[model samples]
Target: MTVYRRGLRFLRARRRAVAALAAWSVVEAGQTFLVGYALARALDEGFLAGRARTGLGWLGVGALAVVVGAYGTRRVYGCVAALVEPLRDQLVRHVVARGVREGDGGALSGLTQQVEIARDTFAGLVMVSRSFLFTAAGALIGLCSLDPLLLLVVAPPLAAGVALFALTLRPLARRQEAFLVADEEIAAHLGGICPALRDITAAGAEALVTADAGARIGVELRAARSLARRGVLRVACLAVGGQLPLVLLLATAPGLLAHGVTPGALVGALAYVTQSLLPALQNLVHGLGTSGSRLEVVLRRLTPDPPPAAAGPAVTRQAAGPTAGGPARPAAQPRPLGVPVCADHPPARGPALSVSALTFAYGPGAVPVIENLDLRVPRGAHLAVVGPSGIGKSTLVALVAGLLEPTSGTIRVLGQPVRGRAAHGRTARGGSARIQPVRGPTACGQRVLIPQEAYVVTGTLAENLGQLRPRPVPEAELRAAAEAVGLGRLMERLGGPAAEVDPRALSAGERQLIALTRAYLSYAPLALLDEATCHLDPEAEERAERAFAARPGGTLVVVAHRISSARRAARVLVLDGRRALLGDHDELVERSPLYRELTGSWSRADSKPALAPRDPDRVDPVAGPGLAGDRRHVVAHGPVGQMQAARDLGDGGTRGREG
Candidate 1:
């Protein structure tokens, strides 16, 4: 259902309170008319007459009824206000949930602001409308009963005033909307400044950012002024218009009384019309001017054509088809523990990744970040991707991490298609597999990403690390992870593993170490290090690279900007623009011009071609082999020699490294 329809439903559900309030307004309007009529009658009859007593009783009764009506209105408004709090709360929850689900924080924030304005402003507007109609109807009926001719006096001016308001309100609303948009931009700009402050100051660009923000605020102020001017003009017209009829009545009432109209009737009708026009016009102005504009903003924001829902029964039915290269079958209904995953049975205990022709674009109109990308990392192998900045290197890493979907083609985690939704659940192939849909450690329970900046929140080190799971990781495990990456000494200097190191005091490298430690704590089958080493020094990089190399089973896809990092990888993939190719570090250095340019590999003089490792097994069947490189030994085999051959290869320094 449309949001406006839903909102209307909500207001309608509170019909009991609305009815009570409307009833109170009717009583109040009736009392206003009665009081005016009583006063006019009393004045005309003269106070010493018995008619004065009758009029005084009505005046007192009218006063009492007004008090009761005010009290009832306040009570009903309170109930309505209470009802709306929960509605605002619901909108907040929807926004939060949408942000977490779709990663659309900006849109969610806008939606939340719109819903709040609607709730707060709409209630006042609806109430005011109720009061306005009550007063206008009561006044018109009383004036008609006294003398229908007065309707002619009020209607023409009231219509003119309404037309004037409507004509001016369009520009007022447009200006108001523009001001609000600018104000929101200013707020977002200020919010973003904290992250960019260091960069801005370092680049001497603080003035530029400040100037930009000031310009936006200046525009907002101008628009606000324009809106205020229009509002003033509208109010001026409404005020003059309301009083015109009253003035006309005063001049005409005495003449009508002279033409055999009772003085009591003329005065009573005039007073009633005066009382009604004053409050009714005022409330109508408020409703149309301020509240009306705010409500329109709310309605516009809340009534966006909602995107099609991504989850539910219909999606499940669609999932029963050839997806991820599997035959069609009914999707299971059981929700996964985390992000939902659906695919074939993953190969038992294989390397954590495979990608073939993985193409992805951020949006429909944007250029494909990674086009026809092919990458594979063997089980327990470390591979680094290096390229120039903006060469889609980060995009490639994100794909391997499974944080983003390929626009076309396929990605497989351990031989299972990592397409559609990835998590552990039923697949179109009618089998269950563990696929982590969302990016993080929980998916497949063995994947982790150490993002570049390594965010640190305001909390104890333990608490930040503890964000990985509900429970705190043991100190021993934390230390082990830290020690694996050369953070042991730092941890020791900072009062050991239980140390409550304030993140603010730590150097960038130190914070990065903590981030790495968090990643290390996850025994994921795959790890994507996206510039994870950027903040580290050479020594720390060496240590971290070694630690990553030592990790077994999981595939390591590293996006590195440094040649030092490329040298440590079993293989290096050079991405130039949207293209990628695989080769050993030196092979890529020699072959790929982009790689040579990036690493300054051409600078080396008289660098000899590195020799490929040799297998001596084919050389001789019986004879024992001689040593080759450092700490090398070789042996050859036979029936008794077979035993010797096993010992020889094991003792030899020929442990293979595959690229």
Candidate 2:
């Protein structure tokens, strides 16, 4: 009731616009009246009187009335805009203010997606309601003027249909709300667990996870079935409101004519019901049923609740020791193994990459896949982001690269805030860290992102490598970069850097080599690799990554596909969808469960895990495909190498450290 009252007040505030809209609508009602009345007058006084020219003149009047009504319809749309924009702006201000005050994370979703839905649905609902109201008025009046009996035949069914639709409104809205909430819960639950499939598979919890996810899915299925049952009312409304009147008029026709109704009056009354009333009522049932309920739900969520009568005591998680007058500190949380990244630890030069309270989601009702995420990467640091597939590792890189915007919070690559718009922001200028926003393969020209499925152009290899650079790269620098990143062989095979590269002819690994060389030769200080080298062999990938990390005063962030990549990084970020765990490899092994499972999975897959289980006392160094481990020695299971060279790249990543 309160939400409704507030809506009435909003409409009342814009009464002048309402008046202008109604005035135009009245012209439309006049059009409806003329359509029926002109037909009847032409039949009785002209055609039946043998005056064909008079009958044709009356038909011309009805045609002219249609033109006037179209003009009025055009004006109605302008009036609708006058009402809708103000409502949208008002909701935006209120939602923003409340979100800031309450720290409600959903505020961004309301602003971007929900508020837009409200605006469109409100416009549709208004147009249908107004059209039905005035159209019913004009149509009923025309019926009564034709004959009193016509009104009696039509009124009962139309009223019954409207009443039935009105009865479904409250229940239908409740069903909609329930189904939406159920859907959200399912999305949120699946979002957390789906990305951790590697962990789940390694832990042997597949059956349990499936059953739990299935239960949530079943809840949504039931809700949808309930919503569909209610939709049957729409068909019933159409039958009674639009179809039943014709049946009744046809049945009562002979009796009505004997009661003194003229033939022309009968035909005009039928036109009024079918043309004006039936079409208007059908639209009203559909538009109001769907859009009206949606608008109500959206508006209620956007509106602020009344203040509580009294303030409640503040809730806090307290440590054992606290002074009587001082505020309580939060209880100790599980910090990662070394150099805790759970809290901000900026160096004197500030972090090279900083993300504060960053959040993102696919839709308004879907879960926030990344929420309140905070981290800082020091300048020139080698950081690896390791997670199971679909854990939003790529999305995180996209946000940092400024290819996509965060739902809330901020991302700064180097020192400049990342804005995902190329039209407004300029590329980086002046100092290296001073980057501007840009929407391209690179962000502000300070950071370069090498995505999976590398892109190759029809031009020469030199042109492809130099595309990221504003000035053409010298032939010597390009060749040096290619040789360093292990692309020297591919370059030689394809003739030379000057040769035109055919993308179709090149293998997937060859394309990745080209992209890697391109990123290495560019001036961007930060390199983001989102599984960019997946197509390459493990050794080739290692060489490329090391070359990029070894770039002077450069930082590297890799979305790792293997444990070797994670181990090579100085620091690692583990995203399990629920929370972020940041630490070094050995530290994460101790503190993070998801990272432990993921590392196990990647280690086995990356390494040729062809080891035979040996007794704890015996060091089975011979069965190891890549390593010769003694009792006191630990070999880091690393990137694949050939024969004797491979033995040094250990696979025995167990409960001990390397000597």
Candidate 3:
């Protein structure tokens, strides 16, 4: 309905072009009328009456009408261009406006694909709609001039077929819309799952993931089948409208001849039926059937949603308590110190981390990877999350870090709600201005998350360390954090904190140390480390973990990489595909078989040849552990970056270490 109203409004605005197009179309209609009328005159007054020259002249007149119709069609193309180009431009503007105002992710798809579809469909609909209306008019009028009986024979079937086709339009449009939505949803589902396929297999969720993907694909299949069913009805309309008229006209021919119809008149009527009426009716049925409903659907999709009736461009959506006739809205009150308004309030009595009935999956219609999960960690508590590789340990860390939103349930940090990635200052919404990242001095800046692979930008070492702080970090604080996380050697070697940094030149372990130091310097009350120290030697990993756990009034959640890491935590959470188990390391070692197996594997790994941590202040700057010594480093599915275990020495270049 919106598309229909929009179409009428567009036509009204371009009345001059529409008028010019109609005038030319009338010339085409005259050509159609003359085509059959000239033949009838030729046979009745010239050829059949023994006047051959007059008959040839009548044929020539019909030929001349075709040339005039060609000129009219050329003019019609210009008028159609006038209408179509503006509509396309208007659609492009509407799509961009919606993308900017509403943050619609599908705007690119609309512009690149659907906008062009709408333009082409609208042009075709315009050409077919006008051509059918005037062509039908001319052919029908010519029929009446020939004989009333011929019109009677042809009119009923044509009217009946057009009505039948019209009946199919609404249902066809619904099917088209359904199919498009289903296709997009399935595409998104597949894109999401592809990156997680290895993880899904590791967790033994192959069957569940497969079932979820199948369900999404099934929806698309059903929609396509429904669309095809409507296509069958369109074919039925074609049979009734275009083909049935011929059969009826022939069956009623004998009666027309006996009822005072001449031979030349009979031939003329046949010409009108076969040449004029049939072709026009066929074009109308096929062209309108395919394009008319399609144009409507595209127009509806491209139209922007209407703005609120009472609101204006000047309205400030931030004022919560303002009324229509009340005093002017006041400015936002300043936040108390240590409070990042969009982040948690750090209530004294509440748990630092709270997750209740949380659920998540890779995509829409995907089975929940973390389903109905609940967790809570009190202030100053150290919790270790231990699980097999790819068992959603990182996912839990991401959810707590506000990088991912749970599908269902709540996540509250220090008594404040974090709205996923949007909570981290960048591109997030607040009152009138953009939201800022949560930060504080004692509570651990709102919270810090260090993932497995560290990210270091090209900047001074001091800049990288202070990246998370809301304000500039002091020189003393930077040096203290660097020494605390075992980055003193790297910092001094790279010419102190002021020296330029290239992330690619740093080893994986060195990068991890820098990220740890950055976290150490943040004001977050809680720290989430998702295997953040995995690349480090055991001793260096221990130092980093100990530094975070010792923070003032801070809570720590570490996705553990080794069995020894679990021993330091006050509590351990073990996640397997079937359920979640929680207890202290010693208690779990005694009672849980899975925990024992994991500890046993880690204990075995510890006895194997592993990298020994070098004392930063004592070790030779140019000489350090190389890939030649750490045999157990390749314990997992692939190589574990032994090249980053220490600096690359000349003789130890790319050695194929332990089997």
- Which candidate model has the greater TM-score, 1 or 2? 2
lDDT of each: 0.60, 0.73, 0.72
Count of residue pairs whose backbone atoms collide, per candidate: 9, 2, 8
Tens digits of lDDT, candidate 2, 297-342: 7788888576676577866764467769997776444221111011
> What tens-digit string does per-residue lDDT give for candidate 3 at 181-236?
78878888778667556434322235556787798889889989998998898778
The count of residue-pair clashes in candidate 3 stands at: 8
Q: Rank the candidates by lDDT, best first.
A: 2, 3, 1
| Highest-TM-score candidate | 3
lDDT of 2 at 301: 84
> So what's the TM-score on candidate 1?
0.46
Angstrom error at residue 423, model 3: 33
lDDT of 1 by residue, 136-197 (tens): 77767766665566666666776677678667777877887787778878887887777656
lDDT of 1 at 206: 46
Q: How close is candidate 2 to the true structure, as a TM-score?
A: 0.52
Q: What's the C-alpha lDDT at position 37 in model 2?
A: 80
